[model samples]
Target: MSSSSTSPGRDSKARAADAKPPMREALVAAAFQLFLERGYEQTTVDDIVALAGVGRRSFFRYFPSKEDVVFPDHERCLADMTAFLAAGTGDEEPVGRVCDAARLVLGLYAENPAFSVQRYRLTKKVPGLRAYELSVVWRYERALAEYLRARFASRRDGNLRADVIAAAVVAAHNNALRSWLRSDGQGDATAAMDHALGLVQSAFGTAPPPPADERPEDVVVVVSRRGAPLWRVVQEIESTLTRD
Candidate 1:
């Protein structure tokens, strides 16, 4: 007998299992459900596992603990942003890759407003969760910094400038995201991100797209002390402009 025919019930059961909710989502739902029912402190991983209808191994498979269920998609977001930065950095004038990275991080928050809001609120209440969330934010920054350093490390900018650029981009992105989250997603995150990156690019004498067909000479160049960090370089230029 053919497999499906030999085990028709097994086929139906397999379809049902496939149709079952995603493990992470199910865990999130279970945790939040129990949190609503029994409070966050009262809800144990065992409770979540039982409530989620999976074994403790399955729960651990998706999240390290009950609290881990709160930011269910964080790992995936980090992976996605890292992948995007890797792909987009290959053709960079530096700022392009930086902006793409900034945009990628913001896009994660934009991907799910409700979850972002929920996670934000929860992070605010839980110190450990808040630290974990901050670490998560920094992970993206670290990845972007590595990419930026790789892109500019061989250029005249060298590692110091690349490090500063990466740090500036990450800082700019975090500030924009905090502003957006503070407004409860009412602000335009994309616009905030774009505007922030524009400032970063202007500081570096690089534009995101570099005005197609324009000669490289047309691009504004800010000459700095060759060894200065990009931030110090921008600061030096700004201070000079203000001095006169």
Candidate 2:
């Protein structure tokens, strides 16, 4: 026995290895506190990792950069949104399905109102964070557009409709989110989001498909001399058609 296997250092290392999830969360919590206490530009990754009691490598292992820690749940929320869109049946309107997907995003923010509000304020102050937020927003919009395009592929204006609806849904979602965040997360977010989503639904959603047995009414077409009187043409056509 080398004795190292039974050493306290070895036991501590094993415990730390098993606690990766909590450690990652610690890093995130520490980063947010630091960003709040000392402005985002003032806080460094070293400060976060030190407060977290973790190494620089651990920070990188969880978040790619300082900005990522601010929106830590984005990856999980994006995946949830994608899953929601993927599970939709094609029978429903594309716009409605995409709107539902947008709800997943709002749900994520709603789950942590304080964190969301804080991040919102910080993002508005930081150009780099805002740009990163835009990239995330673009990814969400692209996912929605792809789903809509697939659903409407057979239609003539499918691509255009898909693109437009996706943009509209994103716009509506962001509007609701910003409103809630601006108010310090104090309003009925669901209601605000519902009102925003309703606009997109009314504008882009298609009515239910007609019954299978439904048929169009027969058209009465009359071809007569261009100068013929209207009463004469109508009477002559009706009499001729009804004769059979």
Error of 2 at 22 (Å): 1.8
lDDT of 2 by residue, 1-244 (tens): 1133655676653455345479878997899899989999999999999999989998887788999998887877787788788776667767778888999999999998998999999999999999999999999999999999999899999999899999999999999999999999998999999999999999988756677778565567778999999999989888977975
Alpha-carbon error at 156 in model 2, in Å? 2.5
In candidate 2, which residue pairs clash?
none
- Give the number of the best model, judged by TM-score: 2
Model 2 spans with C-alpha error above 4 angstroms: 1-20, 209-244
Instruction: Pull out the clashing pairs in model 1.
Output: none
Please report how far candidate 2 places residue 217 from its true position, in Å.
17
After best superposition, candidate 2 residue 117: deviation in angstroms? Answer: 0.5
- TM of each candidate vs. truth: 0.71, 0.78
Best by lDDT: 2
Q: Candidate 1: lDDT of 54?
A: 84
Worst 10-residue lDDT window, candidate 1: 12-21
